[model samples]
Target: MRRFFLFAGLLALLSGVVNAQDEFVTDSVLLHEVATYAPYKKYQAGAKMESIPASQVEIAQSAGLDQLLSRFAPIYLKSNAGGLSSIRIRGTAADHTSVNFGGININSLTLGQTDFSSVPVYLFDSFDLQYGSSSAVNGSGSIGGAAYLGLNGNWTDGARVKATASEGSFGEQLYGAKVFLGNGKFESVTRLYYFMLKNDFPFTRTSDGKEFDQENAMIENMGLIQELNYRFSSKEWWKTAVWIEHDWHQVQALMSSHPNVPSETLDNKHIRIWSEYENRRHALQYKGGLGFVHDMQVYDNNGEQKIGTDRLIAEIEAKQDVHSSFGYKIGAKYKYIKPDVYAYSSDVIDHEQSAAFYLSSFYTPLKTLKLTVNLRQELVTNFDVPFTPSLGAEYRLLITDLSVLKLTGNLAKSYRIPTFNDRFWPELGNPDLKPEKGMSYELGLQYQYCSAAIQTDVKLNGFYMDVEDWIEWRPGSIGWEPENRSRVISQGVELQSNTDVFLRKMSFNFRLNYSFNPTEIKEDQITSLVGKQLIYVPKHVATVYLIAKHGLWSAFADASFTGERLADHSGSAKFPNGTVLDSYFLMNCGLSRDLKIKEQDFKLSLAVNNLLDNDYQNQPDYAMWGRSFRFTLSTDLNFNKNK
Candidate 1:
């Protein structure tokens, strides 16, 4: 096959380079090196502020991401209870982007967001977010961006164990444990996390829709990530690695009782699995996996009447992705979707599948300029094929040893086919629909200055994107049928800055970001959304953090703020006029101290979220947990740093 030959040629080329340099060729491969390196010191501080993994970008210096992230006005966040929500890149709508776990195509699922609350940072080797029109490597219907989560490899050295506990404001309690075992060839890791949110959360509003009594909610998550690698005794170039992961989650629902009615109780669960295999450069990497989700909702209709609703989903996926040092990277993947909803006794199931292939060029002719052109074609089980293309370029200008001028741009065509729930679910199914398609563009500039005494960086970026067939759901005249007759147009801008100062034993970092969006609807029936600020899309969001480090001691302070915005499609009138959730700022403060236990070095940290006990609402009808505190202690033991 063409792929086999391409990979084989690249392997041969790489082997010769490794033999000469005694290195893995990572330095010669920018992208691969970015994935393997720990990142520059300047970037490390910015990652903590943005909560985005460092592997997502390559820069020798740092900039203010907090300020830039705030400009896009993301709806949900890692700090929010609903779940981890990322900013819409290039002003694209949420539906335009594709979401992925490992290599699984999660873009076709019911929910657009993934919960990152339970994934222990230590277990992840790296996380990367590709902005604007993901390539075929991720499958189709991805117009906005793609986020990849990678687990650590080469865990076959020895055995390791760690445990931690923390308690914080709002009756918050946290506990976690992890175990790692390896025999120089096989590896396994198990992690468990438990978080409890009690009634101690404060509420500033009153019973008349004002600040009422504080509410409470709780959640539990358990996950296991295992990887096994086999190295050929004779063929060191040929190796196979297998990965498996499972995650389970449960949560307590929030109560909405600003008036007199008691808060309703809710519970839900989810199970997911991911697996993949890689062959170094010997051939191509093969990956495939599946996911199953069960969601149940129960509530009292009118105090005496009880109602229940359930949703079950099954998703299967398979793909073959290849990376080469020759001229390009290529991949193909397929996904099958089946979802059914049950209310009382009636039920409906919807089925669909998606197949796609992508190609990315890797050869760059210029020393400072790198360009990549990608194309993908996808076919839905019952729809026409859509061809998407993306182009990206990065230029690094060496201004001086301590500073560099970096410029980057991305252009892509995107599309999102209707989901099963969007087209076939009872009371919400719309079969007569067209897949939404779009185009996006972005350009950014960065400057960095890193030295022994001080480190500082500043970045500026401007981007815009538009979409058509922006699918919006329309309720069918019948109690349980649905139609799609809505579309939308969105545009926005972003600006950000970051800086830091390094001292004898302390470091200070600062960041700022801002965004602006004006959107509208095209249909008359959905006119209610016209000229109204997009729901959950804040105009401005910002975060600031300060960190200090001393002999065996580290301390930090962080604060985040979101501007007031519309709550739903109705905007004002019918949706409760002027129901604007007041804007409030939340702060977190923590301190970590190093300790020596036997031959191991342990670090203990105590932190409090919402240190000021500020009352806030993540949603108009739902309030967020009040001040919470946690204590975490961890230590690492390693027998080898370089192999």
Candidate 2:
């Protein structure tokens, strides 16, 4: 109720922001808008990037980032029962991957990572992924990769309202609504979502065939977002957005500890506000954002813990137009982190601040070749962070109206800062720990074929990285403490293929993805740990999916496979150095039909996840859900500008 009242108040306040505005995105030959705060324009000349189309975005609006990425691409997620999920790209640590909203790094300052489960897809208009060490572009915490989520300005002259409701197995429910109004100059978008789940599905222990019900796993979450865009004129515009969400969840005890299960619950709340201004004529842009998060945890022993974090960020950049065959961009950014944790040593609030200046240049000496150089230097109030630099080149061997082939390569430096827990924990924290720094290199080949009826695109890439001064908790004089323990060398191969076929009355789309990642500890204090794969990082992953659409009916089937993974860092005393987990396969399929009733549009879909009822464990002792069904219905109503 409080959230609703706040939403109403903010809505009423933004009601007066109607006026004229201009477009936000511009077109370029090779690299488009790669602004830190802008939408995903991943058609970068020498970068390995991926984008989920608007169709998929619309279908998964109520889902989480984990769901959207996992369903559409071949990515790996470390998931546990009771609504906990995190992502890894190219075998990087969970914290090494960064997720950004409106150009702000949303990773937790205390834990150094974002909980993908808490991020909803309903808040953004775009989903983009950049793989393999984008720290030079996205600052620290992007050693592995970066994800950008943004909302775009709307200039269409129409007002539309969309609503969706869903019910699924194991007591799941979801309701969401989106209201959008736009004129030639002003646009307003409002979204509201509520979801609840009682994850009580029964699962059988693979080893003993013992049956168990997933108990004490319940989740309730709700949120609202309002976006307002106004073009001051053809060359200047301003936009702002506000979001608020609250969630409550229970973490079910693993089956192994059933008899001794403890009652544990967590409550979380998040609030974010973002605003930006841009002038295409001057080639200048400004962005600012503020976000707050609070979490409370309660255990069975009557002990409770609370944590709060606030993030404030600002950025300004200018781009110089082409002079000769070269163009460049320069920007500066600042970020502040305020953390309040009951677990900290002091009762006073602690804060961290960092600022960075970055420069990037684009040069095209020939019609078929493009080159880019990026450099960044960050200054921290505490530790001395190193400078990051990147070089990229793309060469087109063949370019024509019908087909094209290009080669891309990049070399970059990446870094990661010590998290709050790593530096300020009650007693075990280490403030003198060195920052994690790394270097990465990648090469790729891309081919595209297009025709009136058929289109195909294929890309293959390989990457290698070495990270030094890896931070981890180790046994010290008394207990475990954070330290720069070892070095890691990660290497991987990735392949992606997409094909679309348009028929007289039907269209078909197919996509295939495969990745082989092997991350090994190169230099560790413990001899036995050397050459061992990181825990929970898979060596192989593959996915394939197809979408077929007719006049009013559509269907999709997607499947993914994970290879065997290591479950422990230390090998058992007897044989192999570590405990290995079995690989598993999963499949999901859905069908939907569109209907036109009077003036409104309606859609109904049925999806079956884990279609094979396969048994799998993302973590030791934690079992995943089996086959389940979900039914969703959505309605869309549109009114003309005259209305």
Top candidate on lDDT is 2
Per-residue lDDT over 345-459 for candidate 1, one digit per residue giving the tens place of the 0 to 100 score: 2344445566676666643456666566677888777687568876766667655555566676767667777765566654456656677777766777665555555544455
Q: Any idea how many clashes model 1 has?
A: 21
The deviation in Å at residue 464 for candidate 1 is 0.9
TM-score of each: 0.76, 0.90
- The stretch of ten residues in a row with the least summed lDDT in candidate 1 is 55-64
lDDT of each: 0.48, 0.76
Q: Return the TM-score for candidate 2, rounded to 2 decimals.
A: 0.90
Error of 2 at 166 (Å): 0.6
Q: For residue 635, what is the lDDT in candidate 2?
A: 95
Question: Candidate 2, which segments miss by more than 4 Å at Cα?
Answer: 1-44, 156-158, 283-304, 346-349, 573-575
